[model samples]
Target: MLPQPSGPLRLAVGGLTSITDDFAFFTYNLCDYRRTGRSDEARYARVEEVIRELVRPGTPTVGAVQELPGDDWTSAAHGLGHLASATGLHCQAFTDGTRSAAAVPGGHDCLGLGLLWSAEVDPIADTLRYISGGPLWHALVMVDLNVGGHRISAASYHAPPKAGRDRRTAEAGLVATTLRSHAGDGGEIWLGADWNSPSSRTTDGLYYDPDPTEMVTSADRQRWGDDLPEIGYRTDRTPDMIMADAGFRDAAVEYGAPWAPTTGHGPNDRNGPRRIDRILYRPAAAAPGGVA
Candidate 1:
């Protein structure tokens, strides 16, 4: 009998920043080298160019991306179609952007989430979840795939800004629950999100406080609700813990390597360079959805 294929899948997850709200505010900051993990002077003149590089050929890689811009449902679908053309990774459930855009808020001239997968990966199904009460509200994109001889469920999420950790925490919980319900018996689920939560380090290899309690404003308390874990009130609070409890491991923290800050202000800036994005996943297992 032929030996089974060996090796891990090459996956990339990131927040591309909003074309209208975020990127438009800072047009000159399109140094996409971080996402490509390469050093190139090429700027993000068009979203398709960046998408093209994120999942280049020769390697079986998939991308879970946030903030892929689409002005409406048709455009949203088109935006993903463009990525698929550039990377050769088919976009699941991609019809005209016309219909899917309406159910999701940002499709009308705003950023949206997406999944880009390699050819060997067969798309099983996909769905979306709209998150409210964050610093910014956006829909979450989830996709299930069978690749590398195993089933996988993947999702792309961008949480509210750091200004609202309480809300971010709640969003994390919802994401976790969704994964559990969909995970079924077993393959594995990797939920990648631009969590916007601070880590203990910065891109320049410097230490920083991970305290989530920097600004627990009165309004924040109301948003946090009365009952929550003690860590929820800590200065080091992050949505990772919630996902951890949901039974997933942060690939960055587990591997001890992280991509540079995809999009953020400088060290002195309020939204400084933080490796807040991550690939949260369950260990290899066998089950229905492969997400035990």
Candidate 2:
């Protein structure tokens, strides 16, 4: 079971997982060392140069070139080291951005939850190697910390608008499968992504309605019902359905944070189109007084 984000217990945060999607905005920390990690003019710049040389365009591949899994693991480990070296954050890159590299370069975007205290990241190889089916580099990084703890997992995915019910269901299954691998007895697990799922359902299996006490504003509630009901590819299907099936509850639903939405379409469009990009955890038992 995953922990709930409440009472100063196990805290987890997440962001849209689509590393390269413009909609999934976040500075690419992997390549953009200066922007990604802490400050150190000389060190950060040098690390950035090394990454560019390793994966440079139209130049001799100076470093080792391996399969997607190998490359991803290597990159994440390296990135984590860089973060630690710069700011002592000890941040680790979980999902493999290589999935979007071919189509979307500079992909290492993470959910802007907060600094993840800890997590367990998993990677997909076969699917990631393919180009047609979106990136397979998804993960369930277990996080710990409080409000200041910027922690989150990534489920970066973008499918054709036509992929309605079936696709959303399949995507849900994938998230469930991933959670099953890392879930604990009482910790919370977060699945962050540009699920493309309209906020029709909550991660805990409840439908979003116009109850200000239970949900966001009437306009936000209407967005779930009318606009684009079918999230992902299938009709009446969405990413929430996936998390709900996995035994996880919605943080925004169970906890009251409707005012804080995750997926904003554009810069100016602060209150832009919405998606349940950040999925929270529902522990079987609530920590007494919120103590882990």
lDDT of each: 0.48, 0.34
Model 2 weakest lDDT span, ten residues long = 59-68
Task: Give the Å shift of residue 288 in candidate 1.
Answer: 9.2
Candidate 1 lDDT over residue span 1-292, tens digit each = 1112232222222333211110000011122222322332333334446555454344445566665553445555665665566656676542333223212224212556566666755566334334422334555666566654556666766676435455777777788887777765454666666666654333345433233333343322211324343423443445666777767765544444424454333332343344566566665453233311
- Candidate maximizing lDDT: 1
Q: Model 2, range 1-292, lDDT digits (tens) per residue? A: 2223342111112122211111111212122333333455774555434333222232111111111121243443444444434432223323344322211212223211112221222222222211123432223222332211222232223322322434556656665665445434444434433444454454445544222212333422323333354421122445566566667655456554543444342344323444435443444335422312
Positional deviation of residue 153's Cα in model 2 after best superposition, in angstroms: 11
lDDT of 1: 0.48
The segments of candidate 1 whose C-alpha lies over 4 angstroms from its true place after superposition are 1-51, 54-56, 94-109, 125-136, 162-164, 199-236, 258-260, 264-270, 286-292
